[model samples]
Each structure stands twice: as C-alpha cells, then as structure tokens.
Target: MPTPAGADAARRYPVDPNSRLNVRSGPGTNYQLVRVLPYGASVPVNCQKPGETITGTYGTTDLWDNIANGQYVSDAFVYTGSDGYIAVRCS
Candidate 1:
C-alpha cells in the first residue's frame, strides 16, 4: 500500500509499556481491528484525527494516530513523551 508522505520520519511512539495496544482499521473502536501492538513496538504517527475516547494507562484521550495507510491506534495507548508531539491531520 502507498504510505502517507513523510510519515515514516514523524516522531515515533512505542505502544505503552503496560499493555498491548489495538491497531485498528480506523480511528475508533467500532472500526475493524487491524492488528495488536505489543509493548515496545514503536511506529511513527503519520497524522491524527478525533476518535472514540479511550482511557489507557497513560491517560484518557480521544485522539487516534494514523501510523500507516489504513492503520490507526488510540493515542492513549502510545507514549510520545509528555504532551503528544503534534502531528499533521490525515487527509
């Protein structure tokens, strides 16, 4: 699949060390599940969009990061340091 332009170099966020994070087909839990990201699995956040709110170990947030062409993960399940590094919005 064609990747999002320049997304690979965006700041990387590893799934939070506490648990496996869901990688979904879209930004919300209602979307199909794409994969499961184990702790320490890091990926660049290509962009972000508003999604279902998820209260993960890190905190609660309604943001989702598009890490790949059709893959998204809840922002609450990833760690990009304090105050997530803002990324471009996906088209």
Candidate 2:
C-alpha cells in the first residue's frame, strides 16, 4: 500500500501502556477489526480523522489515528502530548 505523505517523518507516540489497542479498518468501532496492537506498542500516526468518540486511557475524543494504510486506532489510546491533532488531517 502507498504510504501517506510525511509518513517517514511522522513522530512515534506511545500507546496506552496498560492496554492493547485495536486497529480498525476505518476511523470508528463500527469498522472492521484489522488487528490488535500489542501492549506497550508505540506507533507512528500518519494522519488523523474524526471518528466515533472513545474514552480511553488518555482521554475522550473523536479522533482516530492512521498508523498505516487502512489501519486506524483511536487517538484516546495514543499519547501525542496534546489532546489535539498533531499530524496532518487524513484526506
């Protein structure tokens, strides 16, 4: 799959240290389950988009982070330092 622009430059962030996060096919839970991230996994968020609001270890938000092509994880489970978009918005 083609990687998003700036993906190589994307900064890696820690997932919720205490939980294994779900990777979805889209930006919401309604989407298919793509994979399950391992505990203590750090991911590079390529982009972000608005999705179903989720309350996770970090905080509640509607942001879903694109870690790879067709791979998304709830931002509430990722620590990007701020409770806001840190990367480019997904197209």
TM-score of each: 0.82, 0.89
Candidate 2 structure quality by residue, lDDT tens digits, 1-91:
9999866656699999999899999999999999999999999988899999999999999999999999999999999998998888999
Which candidate has the highest lDDT of all? 2
Clashing pairs in 2: none
After TM-score superposition, what is the CA distance of residue 72 in candidate 2 from its true location, in Å? 0.3
Per-model clash counts, in order, read 0, 0
Which tens-of-lDDT digit does each residue in 8-85 have in candidate 1? 566687787877788899989999999998777987888888889889867898888899899999888878665554
| Backbone clashes in model 1 | 0
- Which residue runs does candidate 1 get wrong by more than 4 Å? 1-10, 82-85
Clashing pairs in 1: none
